[model samples]
Structure formats: structure tokens, C-alpha cells
Target: MKPRICYTVWFSQRNRSTLLCEGLTATGIAGKPAELLELPPATSLLDFYQVNDYAALQAKLWQQRMTENGVFGMKANAPRKESDPIIGQLAKLSGLKVAAPTPYAVWENAFPNGKHIFLTRRNKIRQAVSWWKAIVTGQWHLEKGGERKVDSQVISQHYNFEAIKHLLLEISLRESKIQAFLEEGNIVPLTVVYEDFVKQYQQSIRSVIDFLGITDTQYPIKEPHYERLADELSDQWVERFRIQLQKDWKNVIW
Candidate 1:
């Protein structure tokens, strides 16, 4: 039986997920290269507002799998707090494992048998700014035009300075989750830092190939175009936001 690979992305928006997904597709795991969202056909006209029922949705996905000739990949943002339990139950019924980035330690704990992969970025402030841009431009989500009210208390709770530091914390948490899995010897997970993955794409891909137990004779990993932000935000603004984020990050974690 062919190995089934499900990639779980944990970032907010506009991160390097597209490049990673494209890379997997080019290597033939996805059969044909396309963005992550291209998988699992649209189930309803209301999909923009919400997802269809889990069991029915998975049934549709399983049906689609009959025609594909390689490992399957499905991507989604963080599961909604309310829907998580149902999704977990459905995954149990379908024999699928959840794959996602490192910061999902809490969620990973909930799905103890799930597989995990961590992707970290070097410049988090740039990432945050990019996330903001994607949100504003309607690429991440549709935002209605208005003066967006910034909740000072909420911002204080989750913001972190030096975006890289936040990235590191996320990495640390993911490493912890990986260690837990290792200690139990139930699953062996893979970790990929964004910088290292980019610098040594082939090596990273080989590591993933080994972890997934893919045959060397069959699917080989490929590199795809990793798009970078064309222009960076002003240093002064970045610094200011960084300070705010630092305070919030500290509050939430420590």
C-alpha cells in the first residue's frame, strides 16, 4: 500500500507553506503539484463560512483518493476549538493521522498518536507583518473595511517582540512534543527549521522521505519556488511592533 502523508501547517497566514506543499507535489507525493488548498473538493456553497460534516467530508475525500496514484496531502489551518473533538473522532474512524507544525503541542497532545513536523522562520517580525498584510489584502481572509479595533488587553496577552524569539518558542514547544513522542516510542517525528530547510532542501527532503518510510526507488523530494516578500516593512515600525509583541509573548508564555 502507498504511504499516505497529511501535512499540517500551523502558521497564521502567508508563511512558506505554499512552497513546501508545492515541493511535495513536485516530488510526486501529491500526484501533481498544486497549492495545499487544492485538495478535498469543495463540499458546499457555504464552505466559505464553514466546513461540511466531518464523516461525510472524509467519505468524499476517500472516494477522491481512488483515482490518485501517490501519497495524499491535505492542509488546513488550526482546528477550531469547538470542532476539534469531532475531527479527532473522525480521524480515528478513518485511520488518518494529523500532520502539522511544531507550535501545536497542545493539539498534538490531544491526538497522541498523530505525526508532527515543525517549520520555523528566522525573521518572525517579518512573518507577522506579512501575516498582517495577507489579512489586510484579503489573501488570508476577507476583511471588511473599517477601523479595526485593537484590543489592548488581548494584544498584551499574545504579542511577542523579536518575531524570531516567538519562532524559537514555537520550536521549543514542538521539540518538547517530539521528545514526548520519542519517549513513548509510539511515533518518530521530523523537525525542519525554515532556514536549514531552505539551505539544504535536498537533505531536508531526504529526512522527511526516511521518516515517512517512503521507498528510495519511488518518490523523491523536489524543491519548489519559495516566494519572499518583495519589500520589507520600515525598520522603525518593525521595531515598535516587535516591542509590543515581546511584552505579549512574555505574558502568554511566562
Candidate 2:
């Protein structure tokens, strides 16, 4: 029997997980076509299966994903809560592979046998600024061929550095949590930085394909068509907030 690739990506919020997944799905793996399965937040296996009893349903869903080619890809963003019945079920579930979303520690426990891909952003300041902006605007992703609206009032005139500072703290803690899990598990993941992936999609995607043992001789490798959500305010806000954190917090590292 030929071996099938089962993998999951552990990412932080605002790190371009969607873009990466789309690219990965484009490349054909073996004789099997790939599909990116996404799990919603706060929903569990029971909710996902849509049944009060799910032992059989879980297996059915898993078998469905496996398809004819036997190659499967699935991703989930870490749920908001630390521990949930659904999350625990996902971690322990057999047969289905897990995929992307930020907050990887929980999923790490859930899918121990699955391949781990760690996608991250190098610029903490920029990531923090982007995350802060999204929280206020409630706009996380931009649609294809859609225009991005920047709120100058909230971004420029009345920007909240204190709130941003706290948000940065949260981001750092999450990153550290993922790092600790990696170390404890002794798992060396296929690490892709957001900036590098943006600059070199082919190389980045190729690295991932290689990791998964996917061979594509005819697939046309292209960069994702999505537009960035952040703008000038994102850069300026990050710079100003960094300086403020240095002065007020004494460059606190928590």
C-alpha cells in the first residue's frame, strides 16, 4: 500500500494561514486531489458531526475526507477556550488529519501523529498592529477582488496604544506557548515565516510540498491572489506602539 500524507499546520492569528492552505491545495499530491478542510471556532466534533452520538459519524467524516486517493488535508484554528469536549475529541480522533489555524498547542495534543507545520510572522510589531486593527474593525480577511477599508479615525486620530500593548502581550504569550509545546514534544516542524512565504511563494510552497512528499510535475505554482488587510496605519501604529512600550513598560518581557 502507498503511504498517504497526513498533516496539520500550527499557526498564530494573522499569519496568512489561509493563503498558504490555498496554495497547498492547488498542488496535486500523488494521484489524489487535495482539499483544505476547515473547522469553525468553538465547535466540537459533536457539533461538527451534527449528531448527539458521533462515534460512527466521526469515522464517516474521516473516511469521506480520505477519498479515493487517500491523501487528505484538514486545518482548524485553535478554539477560544483552553479545554473543550470538541477540542479533546479532535485531538483524540483517529483516521482524520488536522490542518491550520493559530494557537497550535491545543491541536498539538489532539493530533500527535500528524505532521506539524509551524507558520509564523517574523515581525512581531507588525503582526501585533495588524491583530489590533482587526479586533477593532471586526474584519479579519478580505475577499478576492475586494477593497480594503481603513478606519482613519480609529487608526490615526484615536488609536489606542495601551490596548495595542496588551494585545502584543497576548500575542507574545501565545507564541511562547507554541514554542514550549514544540520543545516538550521534541517535534521539529516545517517552519515557514510569513515574510519569506510572501517574497517567495514557490520556494515556500515547495518546501511544504517536499515535507509532505507531494510531487507535482505539471502543477503551475503561483502566489496567492489575496490582498493584505493592513495599510499605512498598520506600519505607523506599530512603530509608535513599539516606542511607547519601550518607554512605559521598560521593554517588559512577559
Candidate 3:
């Protein structure tokens, strides 16, 4: 066996993972990544793959989508505790090979010998706001022809200080954890930041394709037709959060 090559994107919510995945899917080389609808037990995987044994289903799917060069890809953002049953299940699955989950190192061990992409955002405030907005709106993504309307009733156009604070803390911790994991792994991933990707999309796309060892001629790559969900309210919330962080949460380093 020429090594079951699978690329994994280690990311958290509201980090432009969807946008990146969409772009990659457009390239026709990378298999779109999957996310757990809720948490473990991810019984949904059975329906997603339409099989009882998710392990076997994933194996077959990987083999089917894998190129001659031995590359298949998916997105992962699961609990990283060694005791978590989800980790065990993922370990048994064909693609993810998480041997242990200590701190934020689960992803590192999962694909020890496989290519990984560390997708993130630099603006923690914006990231947190986006997450909260998504939770309230219940719209994680907007397709090209999809409706642009966001459900105001979800969050009620009101800024929940507690929600924003919690999200900010979560995003900060995850970002720090990911950094530590990357350093420990001693692997420099093809880092994609949300801000940078949008600024230099064409170059970014090419870089990801090259990293995947796929020839440009292999797929007709096209730019994704999507827009950022952040609006004026998002900006206002980010500003408010920043002020709050500076005032009462000054001791906390985000």
C-alpha cells in the first residue's frame, strides 16, 4: 500500500473552513470535509455515508475519491480527549488515525504522516461575532443562489454580552491550542487565514492545489461564489467585544 494519503483540515467554527472547502471542492481534487451535526455519538455519519459501519464506508469512500497520487481529504473538528468515544470511532475509521488526544494534539496524531491544513482567522473578535451570529441566525452558510436574509429573530438583533464573551474565550483558546499542536507536531501546514485568503484568493487557491500535489490541469478550478456574512452589526459587535475585553477582561490575553 502506498500509504493511505488523506489531507485533513484542522479548524474550528466560523473560520472560513466552509469557504475553503467550497473552493477546494470546486478544484475537483479534494473531497469535501464533513462536520458532526451535534456531537458524539455522531450517528449522523451512518446516514451521511448511508452505511452501518462508518469505518468501512469511509474506507470505501476514500478509495473511491483518492487520486492515482493517493490523496483524499476531509474536514475534522472533534473533541480531542483520549477518553472521548468519538476519538476511538475516528481512529477506527479509514482516514483519521488519532492515536491519542492530549490537549490540542489530537489532529497532530490523527494524520501524523498525512498533509494537514491549519485554517484560521487572525481577528478573534470577528471570528467570535460570526460564530454567535451563526448560532442566532441558524445559517452557517449561504449558497450562490441562496437567500441573503438572516433570521433576526434568532438573536433578536440584540447583542448578548455573555454569548459574545464565551465565544471570544473559546476562539482564543482554540487558536492557542492549534498553535501549540502545530509546533509540537513539528509540521508546517499550509496555513490559510481568512483575511489573507480573501485578499489573495487566486494565489491562495493555487498554493493549496500545489500543496495537495495536484496538477492544475487535473481540475477546472474556479473561484467560489460566496460573500462574507458579517455586516454592520457584526462590526459593531466586534467593537463592543473589544471594548469589553479591554475594560473588565484586560487581564485575559486573547
Screening candidate 1 with a backbone cut-off below 3 angstroms (N, C-alpha, C), the clashing residue pairs are 8-99, 8-100, 159-245, 159-249, 160-245, 160-246, 161-245, 161-246
Q: Please say which candidate is ahead in lDDT: 1 or 3.
A: 3
Cα deviation in Å at residue 73, candidate 3?
0.6
lDDT per residue for candidate 2 within 1-254, as digits (tens), equals: 22255566667778887788777766655222222234587766666667565455445454543424455555544344555445556544443344532234444433333566788888877887888788777788886798666565654775788777777777777777656656655778788899998888888878887787655556656567687887877877877887777776755652
Q: Of the candidates numbered 1 and 3, which has the greater TM-score value?
A: 3
Q: Which candidate wins on lDDT?
A: 3
Whole-model lDDT, model 3:
0.67
Candidate 1, residues 1-254: lDDT per residue as tens digits?
33254334333344465566556556764433222333245333125224466444544443333225444444344443433443444443333354632324433332332444545566655555555544333343222343323433333333334454554455445445435534443544455666676677777766765665556557656544543442323244456675655674646431
Worst 10 residues of 2 by lDDT: 30-39
Q: Which candidate is the best by TM-score?
A: 3
lDDT of 3 by residue, 1-254 (tens): 23255677778888878777767766666655555323445455456656788555555556544555556676766345436555555455444434454533544334434687888888877888899988887788776778856654445466887898898888777766656666666768888888898888777877887887766456766766777777777877887777776776747664
* Candidate lDDT values, in order: 0.46, 0.64, 0.67
- What C-alpha RMSD separates each model from the true structure? 9.6, 5.6, 4.4
